[model samples]
Target: MIKYIGSKRALLPWITGTIQSIHHQVPIRTVVDLFSGSARVGHALKAKGFYVISNDLMTYAYILAQALVEADARTYSQERVQPILDRLQSLPPRQGWFTQDYCEKARYFQPKNGARIEAIREGLETEAGGDPLLRAILLTSLMLAADRVDSTTGIQMAYLKRWAPRAHNDLHLDYPPLLNGPGQALQGDALEVAAHLEADLFYLDPPYNQHSYLGNYHVWETLVRWDKPQTYGVANKRKDVQERKSPFNSKREAREAMQTLLGRIQAQHLVVSFNNEGFFAAEEIEEMLRHWGFVRRLTRPHARYVGARIGIYNPRGEKVGRVSHTENHEYLFVATHSRRVYNALSDHTEALQLSLF
Candidate 1:
């Protein structure tokens, strides 16, 4: 998986444990990840044998879901994927849009790697005959490989002036571990998607602040779209970045957006992941979720993302000495309509505490 801000990679165990605890009470056969950013959580759920519907508004994220969640395990065997990798590795270097912008201008990757990226992307589209699933898997491989060698601090908001050590490495791809089950990937607004979809469980992990994923990861979006978009600013971000704002990014609109989303979700169990730094306080979230059913709150201490760990840097990539908090409190709110389900969670909580002690 690519390095992502606010990714649930470290919290996977806790999240899965919470889901399993609820599953012991109410059978969770289907799960809908309303804001499946990188599809990490949805992929994990699929691997656990739950049918998952992964939804995200970003094209890169949708591709990730298609590769890891929707693509069956048997479809991407080593024999099938290795030849593609070899072809990509053998591609002749061409200085196209990627090499000119990301490599020469922005310094996100070396020119060699940038040329490889461009060649591979073109190959995936033309050679694969634009087959969406196959393209998704191949794109995911390129995305992850690019992530490993990117010069930025786990974000594409800006590139380092000098190339990072990893930027020197050659681009390579490996087969993604695809889950063996029925899954679907969708690209649309979370609120609209939640209204039409019904599942045994709904996982809400919307953007918590004004930093939209589109703006932060514009490079990946451009790569996925391959639009040769008109770019602006020092980061060379796509122009559409301003147009793709979400209501959840506004302080005034976030509460209402969440309220509307929660109201429309039709599910037996609702599990929401939020951070203390979000616009709405924990109490406000609990109150909103309580309207649906009994709400149980779980908290965990987490380290902040890479950029936050270092002192703040302005758009010019200069550290301004304004440091953000190193630690964050992650809150998981579980809402259930059945009293039996609530009691089951309570018993599981007690057992977990006893075992910990």
Candidate 2:
């Protein structure tokens, strides 16, 4: 998947280790992804047999997560889905909501492709009506389908002047295996939501720096949820909700939210993910976690580019363009109320790597 943001999958092995260290004896009881952007973390946890709760402010995020985490996995033989996609491709263009949606400057999806997508969307909606689980199954397929034609590497924010090999050639989308619906999606503040959840261990990967997720990929939310309301800003992006502010985005508020959140968690262990780009210093986060009885463990993984743009160009007409990936590394912070857990983390700088020993 061309993820709109970085995926936690890259650090799963290490995160699992940190979780083992903190709650070695107790069962997961519950795992909460308070900012479940795409629910990657929550899905990973569920696949490992843990009960997962996912939350996100964006309705689209909620929709995507709901399908990925809590919904029952559906098995559609390739024969069953291939015809549907073919029928979708054969559908005629219409001045429907989809055309308007894709034609938006923010969406940047071509009218021809958008019409096919509209057919798929309508087909899925019609097929899944009245059943939440089935709705999620079809939705997961739709999201992947939408990604297939996206002009940007991943997001529609910046289109490349050309396309990469995979994107340029032909996009043949295979439906993602359905997992579950957005797990307990909440359209409120993450800090507020995190405070109320009780779990054995809580993993926090709140937004970092000034990049507003909605600003970059608002269309995905629109695609999955598709309210298609009046929008504003650079590319007619949806201006549906009031923005949520936290210390993570603006350094000024980052501390206050961190303080409030760190003070509220009742979990025995807390693992926070951040990077050097964060305005709050490592020492400050350590101090906050320490005050809450969570000794902090810091791990720095090798930084790599994850957010890449994929597109293709035609001989003359405008086509998809080059790939642009973001350059960044991950920082894992483990905090535990147990001194034994803290000592384990404090004693080893190699805690960042995934070594099952």
Candidate 3:
């Protein structure tokens, strides 16, 4: 998986274990992940025998979910995918929007890699034809490959002053660890989806702050969309970043948004993950969730993203600001009508042990 800032990679075991512990009380057959950013949580749940419905607004995120969550590996076997990836890897370098913007204007990837990315993306559009699954798998492979060679601190918001060591490495595409199951990857607003969708368990992990995922991963967005959009700024972000805003990103609006979303969601159970740096205080989230029945809270302290630890730097690459506290708490709120489900989550020993990571 890609190195995402708010990724549930470290918390996967804990999250999955907490859900599994509830099996004795209420069997969870289907799970709906509202903000399936990177599809990490959805994919993990799917592997554990739950039918996952992963939804995200971003095109890149939808593509990722389609490849990992929806598309079954048993159908798109490695034996078949490896040969396709090998051919894509050997495509002749061709300069395009990605090369001109992200490579030359900004230094996200080396020009050589950027050209290859452009070529492979274009090649796949023709090669995959009308096959959504094939298109998703190919794009997922390309996106992960680009992520490995990106010269940034795990985001597309800005590039490092000097190219990172990994930037020099040759770009290579690998088959994503796709799980075998029946799942759906949707592209739309979480609120819109919650209005119509019903599930056994709903996982909500909305954006905590002003930073938008589309802005942070704009390069990937452009790659997956393949719609050479109008870009601006040093990082070459899509113009749509300024236009497409989430209510959850607003401090004043987040509280109301969360409350409304909680009310709109039709689920027997809900598990929400929010960062300490988020708009709502831990108590505020607890208060909102309490209306649903019984709410159990689990807190885990973890290091902040690498960029925050790097401190603030000027345009000239000089460190100008001191770093604040280097860690934050991830609060997991579990709300369910079943007392047994609440009790199970409260005493999920395996989950607590997994959180030690």
Candidate 4:
């Protein structure tokens, strides 16, 4: 999987455990991942035998969800993946749009790797035989392969001026771990999707602050969209980056947005993931969730994302300063209409020595 900011990879154990605890009280047959960035949680849920509906507003995220959560294990066999890899490796080093901007100008990837990225992306669509799922798997492979050798400090907002060591490696593709189950991938406004979609549980993990995922991972978006969009600034970000904003990124609007989303979602149980650095305070989140159902909060001390630990760097790739905080408080709020489910989650938290309030 690609390295993503605010990814729940580190917190998966606790999250899955919490969900299992709730399942003990009330079976969660279907789950809707309202903001399935990277589809990490949704993939886990699918693996646990739940019919997962993963939704995200970003094209790249939708591709990820389709490849990992929606595609079944039997979809990608060696016969399917080997030929694509061979084709990618055999592609001539052509200076395409990806190379001109991201490689030669922005320096996000080495020229050699960028050329391969361009070649693979151009060839993937045709090779997939008009199957969206197959295209997703191929695109995901390219994205992950490019990310592994990217020179940035784990984000595309900016790139390291000097190539990182990993940038020297050749790009390669691997089969993404696809779960065996029925699942769906959606790309649109989560708020709008919530109104019509019904599920046994809804997992909400909206953007925490002003940092938008579109801005953070623009390269992937452009690659997946294959729009050859006009770009600007030192980062060579897509021109429409500014237009792709989420209300959850605004301090003034985040609370209201969350409240509106919670009110609209048709689900029996809600599991929300937010951190201490979010726009809303923990108490504010608890208060908002309480209106819909009985809410129980769980907190765990977590190491911040890898990018956070690498100190700060300007867009020009100059070292700026150090980050003060080395750790973050991750909050998992479980809101359920059932008292039994709430009590089970409460007991589960107590057993794990996690703080509950």
**What ranking of all candidate models by lDDT puts the best one first?**
3, 1, 4, 2
Best by lDDT: 3
The collision pairs in model 4 are none
lDDT of each: 0.87, 0.64, 0.89, 0.86
Model 1, span 120-182: residue lDDT tens = 888787656667888888898899999988999888888876788999988888777776767
Q: How much is the lDDT of residue 190 in candidate 4?
A: 91
The total number of steric clashes, by the backbone 3 Å criterion, in model 1 comes to: 0
Candidate number achieving the greatest TM-score relative to the actual structure = 3
Clashes (N, CA, C under 3 Å) per candidate: 0, 25, 0, 0
| Full-model lDDT, candidate 1 | 0.87
- Encode model 4's per-residue lDDT on 1-357: one tens digit a residue: 788887889788788888888888888888899899989999988888889999999999999999888887666765767687677667776778889999987899999988888888887877888989888988888888888999987788888767899999998877667766668999899989999999999999999999999999999999999988989999999988889789999988888898899889888889999999888889999998887669998888888876788887776657798788989899999999999988777667888645322
Let me know the TM-score candidate 3 reaches against the reference structure: 0.97
Pick out the ten consecutive residues of candidate 4 with the lowest summed lDDT: 348-357
Q: What is the TM-score ranking, best to worst?
A: 3, 1, 4, 2
lDDT of 2 by residue, 90-132 (tens): 5555557767755544345656566666767766666655776
The deviation in Å at residue 205 for candidate 4 is 0.4
